[model samples]
Target chain A: AQSVAQPEDQVNVAEGNPLTVKCTYSVSGNPYLFWYVQYPNRGLQFLLKYITGDNLVKGSYGFEAEFNKSQTSFHLKKPSALVSDSALYFCAVRDSVSGTYKYIFGTGTRLKVLA
Target chain B: EAEVAQSPRYKITEKSQAVAFWCDPISGHATLYWYRQILGQGPELLVQFQDESVVDDSQLPKDRFSAERLKGVDSTLKIQPAELGDSAMYLCASSLGLERINEQFFGPGTRLTVL
Candidate 1:
């Protein structure tokens, strides 16, 4: 089974401060991790993904994520938080060895950038 | 850029009523997925289609939920006798293929409210 977890239900950060949303995963084989953001009444937007390259992957809206194989974690990060960045964040994983194409997602974390 | 499209941005219905949602994937995309997102949770996959063929539906509730992609272009998901727990957002996504590396494009979800 492949699963992801976002321990925090919500994260609050001051504007211009660095922010992080934690995510951890479990998979039977190598994992393909991804991050997505969703705004109010809108569909989820792709942020970034880690397949098999560098540990740090850059994404849209000045966001990035670090994939730690030893820790089984892929945490989304931003150098400077913006009010517009406040939204719901989700982490997803696909087990490449599982021979399935489906992705398992975490419960999601709500990010609030305070001005 | 081309994107996935969904219909009925919002729906309200009494318990035991039937409701349906539709999705149109981006041109040439061969994989489509339907997901249900409860409040404060990540989207959960309900069904997946690959070129009009059912690829996965392990998590879908067969008793009340049915999905079909007749022409490999558009798809429909119907829930009969919807329960209160069915109130949530129905999301549709598409990918170029079943490869794990392909990113899925999402459509604006349909918010269903079961009264």
Candidate 2:
């Protein structure tokens, strides 16, 4: 079975400071990882994904994530946090070996950017 | 900027009542998914469809919840005898295909409140 874990329930960072949201996963084979952000009363928007590429992947809204195979982690990051970036972040994973399209998602991490 | 569309942005119903949500995926999308998101949690897959055929529904509560994407382009999910636990945001997503790296596009989700 494949699973994802978001260790933090919430993260607080000052605006203009670097921000990081942690995520880790367990899968039977190579993993396809994704990050999504959901704002209040809105649908989740895709941030970025890591299938088979460079360790660091950049995404929408200046967000990026680094896929660390040794750590089994794909942590979301932003060079400079913005108030607008405050939202719920989710990490999802799909096992390529399973040949199934289902994605397992973590509980989520709430990010708050303080002014 | 084609995106998934969902109906009944908000719904309120008494316990034991039946409620349904609808989704219209982007044109040409071959895969659609239904997910349930409880407060403060990431969305969980309830069902997945590939070209009007159910590809995965293991997480769906078949006893009380049902989903159908008869025409393949649009889908519906129904819950009978709604329980308080069913009150949450129901999200719909669609993707191009079952490719391991395909990105899913999400809809604005329908918030259901069981009273």
Candidate 3:
């Protein structure tokens, strides 16, 4: 079974401080990790994806994620938090080895950047 | 920027009523996906289409939910005799190719409320 875990229900960070949203996964084959962001009532926006090569991947809105294979983790990060960056973040994983295109997503983590 | 499009950004319906949502993928994107997202959770794939053909519908509730991409340019999802549990945000996304390695572009979702 392919599954993703976002342990934190909410993450609060002070403005201008770095932020991290944790994510971990379990899958049968190699994992393709992705991150997305959603604002109130809107659909998700793609952040970044880790298919191969670099362990650290950068994406939209000054966000990036690091794919750690041994740890089975892909954590979203930001160099500096902004109030506008506050939103719901989700982590998803696709198992290439399983030959399935469907992605399994974790329960979201709400990011609140204090102004 | 080209983006996926969806209709009826908000809908409120009574239980047992029928409802439908429409989506148009980004131009030149061959793969389309429909997802159901419950609040506080991640979006789950309901169906996937490659052009005019259905690639996957395993997660869709066949008893009531049905989806089609008649010409492969746009698609529609219909649900008959809706239940309270069916209330959720229906998101539509599209990607560039068949390999499923490309990042997906999402639309503003349709928010459904079943009474």
Candidate 4:
């Protein structure tokens, strides 16, 4: 079974400060990891993904994530926080061995960026 | 940018009532997905369609939930005899195809409130 875990239920950060939302995965083989953000009453928006390339991947809205193979972690990070970035974030993973395209998501982590 | 479209942004119904939601994926996309998102949780895939064929529906409650993508363009998800637990946000997303890393574009989602 492929599953993702977000250790924090919420993460608070001040404007202009760096922020990180932790995520880890459990899978039998290689994993495809992704991050998505959802605002209130809205659908989720794709952030970034790690398939098989560099450890650090850049995404839209000035956000990025670091993929750590040894840690089995893909933590989303931003150089500087913005009030508009406050939203619910999710971490997802897909197992390569199963040949399944289904993305198993974490519970979610509410990000509150303070101005 | 092209976006997935969904109908009935909000729906309120009583237990055992019938409800339906529609979705139109971005042009040229071949895969469509329906997800259920409960409050404080990430979206869970209810069904996935490759064109007009059902690719996955392992988590879908087959007894009450049914989905169709007749023409391979637009899709609809229907639920009969809805339960209180069915009160959730129904999200529709689309991807180009089944790849190692396919980005899924999301719709605004339909919020269902079962009374």
lDDT of 1: 0.93
Give the clashing residue pairs of candidate 2, or none: none
Q: Share of real interface contacts recovered by each model?
A: 0.79, 0.81, 0.74, 0.77
Q: Residues A38-70, candidate 2, lDDT per residue (tens digit)?
A: 999988889999988799999999999999999
Give the Cα error of residue B80 in candidate 2, in Å: 1.2
* Runs off by more than 4 Å, candidate 4: none
The predicted structure with the larger TM-score, 1 or 3, is: 1
Show model 1 residue runs off by greater than 4 Å: none
State the lDDT of candidate 3 residue by residue for A1-115, as single tens digits. Answer: 8889999999999999999999999988678889999999888988999989999999999999999999999999999999999999999987566555777789999999999
Give lDDT: candidate 3, residue A61. Answer: 90
lDDT of 4 by residue, A1-115 (tens): 7899999999999999999999999988777899999999999999999888799999999999999989999999999999999999999996566555777889999999999
Please give the TM-score that candidate 2 achieves against the real structure: 0.97
Collision pairs in model 1: none
DockQ of 3: 0.77
Model 4 clash pairs are none
lDDT of 3 by residue, B1-115 (tens): 9989999899999999999999999999999999999988889899989998887889999999999999989999999989999999999999886685877889999999999
Candidate 2's C-alpha runs over 4 A off are: none
RMSD of each: 1.0, 1.0, 1.2, 1.0
DockQ of 1: 0.85
Off by over 4 Å in 3: none
Model 4: DockQ against the native?
A: 0.82
